[model samples]
Target chain A: MKDGLVVLDKVSYGYSPERPVLARCSFQLDANERVGLVGTNGSGKTTVLKLIVGLLKPTSGHVRIFGQPCCNERDFREVRRRVGFLFQDSDDQLFCPTVAEDVAFGPLNMGKSREEVRRIVSRTLSLLGLGGFETRITYKLSGGEKRMVALAAVLAMLPEVLLLDEPTAGLDDAAAQHVVDVLAELPQAMVLATHDPRLLGGLVNRSLRLTAGRFTPESSRDWAANPAVRSARQQTA
Target chain B: MANVIENAATYDASFVPASVWRLDGVDPRTRLIAAVSFSVLVTAVDSLPTLVAALAVVVVGAGWTGALGQQRWKRLIPVNLLVLMLLGLLPLSGGATPVLSVGPIVVAREGLVQALWIGLKANAIVLGVLVLLARLEMASIGYALGRLGVPEKLTHLLLFTVRYLEVLQREYTRLWSAMKMRGFRPRVDGHTYRSFGYLVGMLLVRSVDRADRIVAAMKCRGFCGRFHPLDHAALTVRDAWFSALVLVVLAGLAALEWA
Candidate 1:
């Protein structure tokens, strides 16, 4: 088994038999590598991320993180400590009442001291250009603001690998650019699953498309040049 | 569309004002103690004069705490409706002295007084809670409860419910709007009923799914069956003095009730 930061060895997962969301998928995310997973809706892009983070167990194949097999909560601790997974839905990620509390949640859960957590929370928010938003109510924030805050919460953990699932799914151009700029500055390995190839333009070095429950290597231009995808991006833009 | 959800999901923070009042600066634990103690005393009183006096005190407290604003007054409309219903119904049950007699219906003065006393008690207690709690944030309430030895599980439930209520409301609104876009005009029909039922079921399923996702997110952040608060406000002398004043006021109200 090749040691990588995150490795999925022929992982296959299904909510029920006779149907699998991810079928014998295998990939490796090494340190400082930027990988983009692109697929149509229901192509199981998110399942792959969940499998990497130990949120879902593979039915047939093994998954490894940092050369250790991730099977349960105990094993996931190491994975979670080193990898930050940004949920596709900002609402699901930012559950705390206040922005500051949500951003501090990861650090606090990591058992960081109060002062250290506060400093990291402030620094992370400012890095995401969300300074002075500490006391702002979470639900009151705009979608763009929520996305940034959610990212801040994940980044506050200072993970070595980022598993982002559609980080710019519902964001505007400005917000999307903001996220791109921030991710550009970060030095962590990232696996970004997004419909927007524009987001992967300068960020991801390699792209894979999940088709018929299996991942296949594909050029980013193939997805970006599709007429339907281009039209959808223009409509949202 | 994102903006619409953002507007719908916005928290109604108007319950607590932006500008700080003296009461706002008071410790949340102290305010919680005061509200609970005064509410108990107000509920215990049955006399019209005492309840009326308590109501007056509540109004004054609300005014002092900056809670006697148009928004806060709007929240009391349903309470007023309940009180009106009590006033209208209580008089129908006859008493010794009749205040109004009309075709086979007599409103007794005793019954009217009894209803008024109960209404006054309810108003006073409700106002007490509004004035005391309107200055504190929801997080502070959970913190104060946890500090006061409330079970961690209960406090966590309260905090999560309060935090997610707006999110759920937004989800419902979005679903309803989607239905409306599809020409779903609700009326008294089987289709409408079925549609509404499906909406509810969808909401429940989405809520459960979201809950699972949230739990997964928490665990991903290393949450291991414990909620560690990032900020903890220590009890200060102001809290002590405010609690002392509340105790004195409760004692006085008790004395007035008996005397």
Candidate 2:
């Protein structure tokens, strides 16, 4: 197996064959790499993430995770087991009745023993400073707390590569800052699709831009000119 | 008072606190066993006296859990009234041994006894359902059902419904508010039905759009819809003992009746 984390070779995808959402995009990640995906609303940044996670298959290309083709169910499941994801809407990601159950979901899905699952869930909760909230109903949590719980659930899965979609949206200044700090401290390689400048600032060393329907390299300077980007940066830093 | 009982048995958003419930004291499985046993034993009693005793036990149990708050009683009254009315009308139908006669109305002894038994049985069943809900939360119920050989796809659907019901409700409220802002009102005539039809159509469209976005998001996160219950607290020795005790007590009562 190759040492690289992920490899997408000339991948092309679309909802319908006539309308290609993502066109022949290719990208790769190495161990401990931090990459930021930036694009407009209709751009195919989200599509790329879906393809990597095997949610959507590319029309004609290959997506490899940990050196293996992520096309079959067995391959995708193996990849999914080792990759934690933070979805755009916190509500969509969190579906459990209680905070603890939500956080323990991924670990449980991976079929860990009961004791180990409990320990990992508790540790992740406390690490996020949510120690006294095991039994709290998930719906009753504040937006920021819900985000933390969502991340904690994935962290419990203990993935090697983490993918986040707008992790800081709806969070207040303090909560967003806390999220930034938490993301920075993670040992895993990360690919963040975000509009939060604070989350993308000094933390991510590489930036991938998606325009119209293709992937291209971009710089921090290019990202600074956009009004939406400016607002997100101001909110964070 | 009526509202109190209703709130206890029904879904109340206010009852769900921000903090998680502790699973330390009693195993949910054991509580489930106890609840099922109690419900069956009480439901089997044909005598009014035994039925009343079962209802009392249920009430006491609810009280111990602090679930017998004002909300619980409020909910129970309407159902109680309905049961009363049904039983009251039963004596009027056919044969009657008139213990008391008032003009055209005859209150028969058998009818009175039968009504008491019916009320007792109804209360016992209601109490049992409430206790089961409180002890075995939705997640555990889903897990138990899944373990009992329910199909994964159906279980996922149930789980999705549970998760998204609140989201759908919030969306519906927002849609209603938007309609109200536009001076939309329900008329008593046929126009009201047409307007309602329009509203439902819009709701369906919105739901489909929301579902699409949700599916996209879930796919990005590697969701395949086969849910596995997380580190569930273990069923302890105490749990077994309690379950056995409940079963034994109910069996003894049943045996006595048989003898």
Candidate 3:
């Protein structure tokens, strides 16, 4: 545990005690590292990312971020400020009237000046090749455009770590490729929970396999570093 | 990518205010103020000449701005229905002189005048809002309300509803199409009602899920209780001119009502 940026130690969670989503799950995201999380549809891959950001409280486990225990909402406030979470559904993340407003929401909430938020919004939108989309209505945007705008909204906060859930799902090849290209250039550490194995070629440095509420034995450091594999399962979390 | 975004504007025509109004440049606060003043003045006018004059002014303004999308006159339908009902019922129930009647139903002249005044006043207010305020985007209205000393929470509710109305509408349509594909026809029966009820329940449940996710996303970016709107651009000369023009019309209506 070499000062992992995020560490989930023996975490267990369930919507109900009778059915468990994640049990004794342990993982870590190191600085400047990009780890791809793969699992079946309900294997709790999403739960892992949520646990990292304190979006969901574990039934029993220790969740640490920036080397501090995040057991309550107040502690997670700091964690959330440094962590960007991209939702699986773009619609869930975009609640503002316009592209610029949605992008500015986070920064403005974080107490950034209006002028500074505007600058960040423009920069983030352009970074995703969506420049000049400030005033565009969010609902009117096409699917691909909406995805990029959602990404811009998250990136506008300038988080040090990103937890992206199915970042490339449902996108056409070009659109997904565009996302892959932009994400590959980012300096932040990220845990990409995705089901697409080959969509983002050479972008993820390693992979982890989650199953039945826990990581597979093969997901240990030995095989996770290997570059070749069949379809990878990223969490919808 | 530039082409993709450039193409976004092809569908962007509907959201932005059209310049045909010759008042698109006016600030929304100005338009809102004008609408308030016009509606108030029209409501106070009891004289037939003043009410008719106000209605005329509103109808001409509506013509100048052009109507919204389609079904332009559909909004006035409910008002017309109510007016017709009043004209028929009010004249029969009261008033002084019997103008016309068949059998036991006698139409009274006083009741007719009262009904006519109510109809005119209603039409004038509705038409006035359509011309002066309805053309503005809903977001503009929320912002104007905030600027007009409306409570922050109320304006937030307005803006939030506006932001997600289309999205929720699409969700509703998706559910409806799924139902249609499954041979679900909206017949006037228990089965149809139950199915519709179930659809609404599912939509509400999904809305709760979406709302949860949206809040989580917001928190992920350091949101507390406060919300910040981006720009607070000052009202321009155009807004002033528009406000002045609206005040003049309102003043003229007052003179007619009293003089």
Interface RMSD of each: 1.0, 2.8, 1.2
Error of 3 at A37 (Å): 1.5
* Clash pairs for candidate 3: A38-A233, A39-A233, A46-A237, A194-A234, A195-A234
Which candidate leads the pack in lDDT?
1
Tell me what fraction of the real C-alpha contacts between chains A and B each candidate also makes: 0.85, 0.48, 0.96
lDDT of each candidate versus the true structure: 0.83, 0.73, 0.80
Candidate 1 residue lDDT tens string, B1-259:
3444444234245644456565756878888888888888888886666777788888888878777564666557668899899899999998999988999999999889887777777778888888888656687898789999999999998888777877788788899899999999989999999998999899889999999999999888888888778778787887788888888777777777897
RMSD of each: 3.9, 5.2, 5.8
Give the chain A TM-score for each candidate: 0.92, 0.91, 0.90
Lowest lDDT 10-residue stretch of candidate 3 chain B: B4-13
What is every candidate's C-alpha DockQ against the true complex, given to 2 decimals? 0.76, 0.37, 0.74
DockQ of 2: 0.37
Instruction: Work out how many backbone clashes candidate 3 has.
Output: 5
Off by over 4 Å in 2: A1-5, A28-32, A67-69, A216-219, A222-237, B1-24, B62-65, B84-116, B131-136, B144-161, B189-259
Highest DockQ scorer: 1
Of the candidates numbered 1 and 3, which has the greater DockQ value?
1
Q: Rank the candidates by TM-score, best first.
A: 1, 3, 2
Per-residue lDDT tens digits of candidate 3, residues A152-182?
A: 8888889999999999898986687678777
